[model samples]
Target: MASNVVVDQDSCISCGLCVNNLPNVFRFDDSGKAECFDPSGATEEMIQSDAIDICPVACIHWQ
Candidate 1:
């Protein structure tokens, strides 16, 4: 099953970890918060471990 990742803007701390590592899937929005611009940009596995797992603010989640 393919999973879509989402970033909780309210919980985001703008750490840049997700954006810096998984730029294809995540990016900094106009508000400078991390957002999932393209859920299909990266593999679900990579998104889970690299973005969700490493999220300092626990803002990234599987949708």
Candidate 2:
């Protein structure tokens, strides 16, 4: 199954943990908030789970 990793902009604290952990999947905007480069485009399971695990607010989810 293809899983999408999503980050809630409102819940994000700009900790940058997700970006730092999964650069291929996550990025930061001008406001310093992390955003997904391509949700549901993960080619590896480990990267998807890494983003979910490092999200400080646990806002990142896959479905």
Candidate 3:
């Protein structure tokens, strides 16, 4: 499946929750916001549980 994960930098608090939990799929950009570097890096289930669900700011989502 194609990668559909995305992050709202404007809403992100840069808490590192997503990156810490799913490093392969999420990471901090140069501006210090959480961004999806590789949506296909992890399984959809893992991304949903680890990044989307665990995000304190709820900035991550499907695109």
Which model scores highest in TM-score? 3
Model 2 misplaced regions, further than 4 Å: 40-44
Per-candidate Cα lDDT values, in order, are: 0.88, 0.74, 0.89
Return the clash pairs for model 2, or none. none
The per-residue C-alpha lDDT of model 3 at residue 51 equals 89
**Ranking 2 against 3 by lDDT, winner:** 3
What's the lDDT for candidate 1? 0.88
1-63 in candidate 2: lDDT tens per residue?
Answer: 666666788889988877777777889888778888776445656665677766778877765
Better of 1 and 2 by TM-score: 1
Q: Residue by residue across 1-63, what tens digits does model 1's lDDT show?
A: 767778899999998999998889888999989889898998888888998999988888888
Predicted structure 2, TM vs. truth: 0.72
What are the clashing pairs of model 1?
none
| Models ranked on TM-score | 3, 1, 2
- Estimated TM-score for each candidate: 0.92, 0.72, 0.92
Higher-TM-score candidate among 1 and 3?
3
